[model samples]
Target chain A: MTVAIDRATGKRRGDRTPRPGLGRRLKNGYQRHWYAYAMIAPVVIVLGVLVLYPLAYGFYLTLTDADSLNSARTIGVNEIEATYKFVGLDNYADILWGETAYDRFWSHFLWTVVWTAACVTLHYCIGLGLALLLNQKLRGRTFYRLILVLPWAVPTFVTVFGWRFMLADSGIINSALEALHLPAPQWLEDTFWQRFAAIMVNTWCGVPFMMVSLLGGLQSIDSSLYEAAEMDGASAWQRFRHVTLPGLRAVSSTVVLLGVIWTFNQFAIIFLLFGNTAPDAQILVTWAYQLGFGQQPREFAQSAAYGILLLAVLIVFTSFYRRWLNRDEQQLAI
Target chain B: MTTTTVTPAAGPAAPDAAPTATGPRRRRGRGAALASHGVLTVASLIALFPIAWLVFLSLGPDKDDYLHPGRIWSKMTFENYSFVLSETNFWHWLQSSLVVSLGTTVIGVMVAATTGYAVSRMRFPGYRKLMWVLLLTQMFPIAVLIVPMYQILSELRLIDSYLGLVLVYCSTAVPYCAWLLKGYFDTIPFEIDEAGRVDGLSPFGTFFRLILPLARPGLAVAAFYSFITAFGEVAFASTFLLSDTKYTFAVGLQSFVSEHDAQRNLMAATAVLIAIPVSAFFYLVQRNLVTGLTAGGTKG
Candidate 1:
């Protein structure tokens, strides 16, 4: 590519003689795109080193017994021939059906799906409502926007810890409920309430982004559409169903997809809230963390295998979404 | 500016017809609408209650004896803030956080802006392929990279250093920042760059003088986001920066939970202190943050 580019530059400069041939033409073509290539070099080099190499290295380490004890044992006979050494596909199989692995593959998969869906759905509902309310020419709009954005603005850990404290046995929410003569539900103790609190906190942090995004989307929908629907004597529900929903479809879909990916990979809330207390609170990523870093001789390959599985699932969903969007685009073009 | 009279597009000449739904009873519909909005506002306040509680708790007295369980007035004091600011390594950690987050923002935006411009406006081989690769990279859990990163940073003798944290944070930020900036760049016409190239300036000069200036708002948005991400990042910093002096404010606040003394008030005060800087920065750059966040979601 380099030689071709140089030759093309030479031809473009008219410094070369006739009969420069196909090679020269190819080089000239490359030269035309040289600056474009130059512009992209930093991206390739930076991403290649930091992202691609590490990702590949992560997979490589998965094939070897690169546990904590094998730090310096990169290449050796006994370690290689050991029963635990260099067993290709065994780690993956172990994660899939290993007795010791707390996460049954299918259950973790189901939990991930359920968790993602519940969080995103609740966030969207609350977010869309706020966007609708704020989109109005109302009083104290900026103040409300600032207030609503706080949950997302604060650091993830601080918000998680705050929720943990509030949900404690004798914390603020319980205290407030007691003062109000209302029953304080066991938020962090019961299995159902633990999940509920996690979802509530996660929704608090997640909803603001969607609200802001939908607010921007709402601004773009030509008010004339709504006005036209009104002139036709269409009800508010009918107008929203036809005009607002279609207008919000694109942004809402993007929000849902990104929300799923982020929520699935969330570690801070569940980790800090449960903190090794409830074994079932260990999601896929947190489980990976405990197995990889919580032990004396860490199982790096098993952790990597788990991460790889998560990545595979995400890729499948993303591609499925992309295909779905592409079909929509094609239909629109038609 | 004086108000100009423009004709209504298609609604009722007066706005009253739309607000009043097609009910025989106008009072009931209006009342229901008001009630629903009131309910929504109340629900939103409930959602926002934790931060409100955090603020009040920070201002509350130290969690010591004379623990009056019921009276809220008795808990109001400023001692926790004074103690948190004076006793702990809060100042040093705050300074470290500023350095690390600013470094990540500056480097991340500088790299992403140029590369995003190239990707969005310039055409070359493997351009589409590069975007696909970058997008796919986002799915992988970055925690998986921490151990290898630890090994590499350790070998480089950069353990517990701001330089090490900055580099890792900036690297993780590059993909998303670049992708968003590319979306922004796509909005700017290629003719701007073409005009620059036709004027005989080098591509780099054109980018700096022409494109970068025009993309300032977008760049501001990207930088704010990158800054916030780095500022709030805890996982890698906690794992990598082992020394106490090297801790960012995020982990420093966790120190209040010692084995012996659990100063809930002081910790809340510290959390409030850290949150103020973050929230202030967000408020300052909110316009850009909103734009950067909603980058690819909406068309117009």
Candidate 2:
């Protein structure tokens, strides 16, 4: 540490003044920022121990061929050291392109994309619609909002179970369908139904938040803009497109980013609703989870690789999205 | 200036209406109001159906009565609720869940406030980097962290323990809370901090005695968020809490579903029991939640 500090000291800029002593410089920085450092110490420590360290450890685990069976264990001090061998890049390779595993990986990735896209789009549209409706001088607006936001207020696992109940083969939804003389398909059994059920429940669970968020966005828009648009003889659609959309730009971007990330990694709905069901219905996050913990002979290395890949995909997507948002700056030579 | 800077976008959030509560908005035709109401009512029905169905199912006498809806209508009873209360480990799960959730909320909020205030008020050498890290951490989610989390938890002999779960929940909640509270703290005036310093108060005194009390709304939002997040978490709870005795509601509820038998009635009862308190808790804090959320969200 002292050597590193000494190295830092060797570089002097063109300010032809006497440089402070190394100890004084060190003391200065500490005196200047100690409060800030002290304040953040708990956060830094907690995040380090729980997240960063594990992330580093998870990367290392991915380099080895570890599984529940072969990995180290301690049964009351009868310590069994890990027998798993270092097989660098093998787990990643197997997960990405090994024939049987590749099929699973690619299919799950595709579904995850579809699921995330479908759910976020639906949530945003429906939420925006609901927000727009409630933003008016309509009767019982509060009443309607309170009821609509119920799903979000309830715990996710509970609501997932609620959907599971209603979507079951002989559950009320099917029973209602049959009574109305509509054909009742096997919701719990069929692959299409499984995927549909997952998306439907997630959308139902998600839309309330989007609605509330967008509603907040709607409220925040200056009413004077609407009046100005009206004075200019802009139609409702025209006013919405020009005024409302721009006004909502900030809230919309953040929520959409959040929505994408949340929907992409949605686990409890998939896991609790369909416990180790059809592989075709599984998304990548849940698939990785099932690999690591849900199934017997838990594939720790493979699962960690899947997780790293998922993180990589999200980072790539976010960076691209950021670039797209900043494209106007480039175009205008800002 | 801070208020306008936030554009602090929270009001009685409209479901599908404008906040143009005066002037020409009230002059909309009766037909338009009816149409808006019609759409909202239908949407509300769709939103409420599954939950309402769960509550109804919970009252049925037999577990299989859901499959035969006609039987449930004929003989509705609270037997399932009784069974879930008396015959199972429901109380234990509920207690453990509350312990972990409360612990996470207390620790997460306390830890985050300092970080939040630091980032909001200070420009230390690594401040920008810390903010960036907090932002990036959201994308590196539960899936990526689960395996290593398991390994670390076990090493500390923390698996199946409430403290273990609380610590794990903190990793997910604290960073986000820090990010959020920074936005909130930004809304508070710098004059107050200066005033605090004038009174010969240390930075900590100024923060805890002055800024914190004033930042109640933000702290409430942060606390509520932390509580809900830790309460509803499943992947970690199911994996780390190895024994049934340590199971949270999430872990315990799943056992009923995967049992290869009909326990939907009891599951429904438990679901209803859990949802009431949580939903009520949500109701208490939702206004602040929305306000704090949009304050940060609008800045994005």
Candidate 3:
């Protein structure tokens, strides 16, 4: 009713107004754009509250001793006198050096890098291979493609735990190995094998994305180029190298960047398989979870320190990607 | 939009590069091609082995029979399925998941649609900056946000609630949705809205009554993505929603296999049940997904 009222008032004024000058046109533009502004307001507000605030809060929380159980307290002036009162660099140092903190922080950090690298590389190799194979003309390609994508389509917890179960002592893998007169690797009991299992699970979850992306890229490639390469006396390898690979450059780069970020931050495969109980396999994210949720004497400051460190690494990666993208564009322009 | 044309290799000018056209030679080529395809087909099966193993385990003769599928079989049974269905709280948890996923999709689409429309069609100050900031948000690791988000949600008394999970899910989904939707909306002609305006409809009516109908495919894709994402996301659900009754199907299903006791067959059955609906959902929306993802690149 109020909206109608304002409309009627504006309509009455519309009949009596002399045509607006340049200044008034500018003003009218602002007035007309208001609805658009109003529509976008909620999105901006929600992002600010949920994303921006937490990011800022994460940075601030690093300087405080606000443990989950502690209820956000000050560490006092005497503690400050001892250089331990909400000190900024101390938490960073604690995470950097195993000195004032929880155990195996560095080990987890190293594992995180290795885990991400393995996941990304395996996903790329298998995914690109699948993309190339499926791109070829084949009978029952649709069915085969659908079956391959099943691992990715299923939810994470189900498949991650499913793999975990398969790796169990009396599980299918062990059973199959025993039947074949081969020794079953103690998949969960060992550190390196467990990490391999984690990577396998992560790769299982991740490859479909890369495959789909590469498929899209391959389909977009101009087939005439392949024919042209063949006419130039190029073998299959040369044609694929010169045509298909170059054709896929942009999509492939984007795939690698996205895969890196996703695998780097992947938590479920490791957390569900190993949890905090595995002293060796914990990543930064799982380590943070342990500090906050896994233990009683939770160290919020140290967790925040780890969180901040992870953010810095990711930010650096993002900027590097942006620069890489710009360079690619420039080269293409040339 | 640069269309660089490469000259064809096997065209009339380069006829010498062709393989021998003799029948026997062609037969051998076909045989080799078939062999290569056979190898790849086997490889594909091996790649899909885990899923096959899952299906077999679910339908195994008994819980122990799964450990020895090649050996003397006990018998096939629907007992695992019945055990997962009738004896467990899985159905209830599945219902919770459906509600939370559907709710997040609805809210996310609504918000992203309106925002995307505005950014695409309207002249607004700082709009570009806002878009960039939203993209920048994607750079932050979800792991980095975990602790602070937990604290904030805890403060709001939203922990262990559908509302918290939905909010978090929608927040993460909006940036990509909005980006994609904005790109989609830009491809729409502005003349349609102008025509609606001249016909005496309000700007709101122009969008709701005219533009939205045209953007239906885009909206469907966005909604489908949001739903699948909310449906699959387990980290936030497991972390935030602690109560057993409130737990989503994914998390609840995880509880089937604990530290000491694990019903591998029963868990497989439950997992199969979970996969059915999600797979069905994917199948239903499969066509739209390919179109949606490619739309961002092929269109302006």
Give the winner by DockQ: 2
List runs of model 1 lying over 4 Å from the truth: A1-29, A73-84, A100-105, A178-185, B1-33, B64-72, B258-260, B297-300
Chain A accuracy as TM-score for every candidate? 0.83, 0.88, 0.82
Off by over 4 Å in 2: A1-30, A75-77, A329-334, B1-28
lDDT of 2 by residue, A1-334 (tens): 0000111112221121123324334665566388889998988998888788999999999999999988877988698888999999998888888878657798899889999999999999999888888888767989999999999999999999888778888788888899899999888789998999889899999998999998888898888887776567555655677788877776787789889999998888988888887677889998999899979899998899999999999988887776665564357455
Count residue pairs with overlapping backbones in model 1: 3
- Quote the positional error of residue B243 for candidate 3 in Å: 1.9
Please give the ranking of all candidate structures by TM-score, highest first, separated by commas: 2, 1, 3
TM-scores of the candidates are 0.86, 0.90, 0.84
Query: Compared with the real two-chain complex, what DockQ does model 1 have?
Result: 0.29
**lDDT (C-alpha) at residue B300 in model 3:** 16
Candidate 1, residues B1-300: lDDT per residue as tens digits? 211112112222122223434444354445444644675578669667888777776766756321333454675778878887898778888889889999999888887777887766554678668777767765666556765666567557677899989988866788777877876776676667667867987778888899889988888888888888888776677777877766887777666665327777787888888888787777787767776666633321
Candidate 3 has a DockQ of 0.31
Docking class of 2: acceptable
Q: Candidate 3 lDDT, tens digit per residue, B1-300?
A: 211112222121111112345565355446545654775687567667777677777887455655576652456677889887888887789888988999998888887788888866665677657766765665566666777888788767798899888888877888767766876776676678778977988778888999899999899888888888788776678788888888897688777667216766788888888888888778777656755754443331
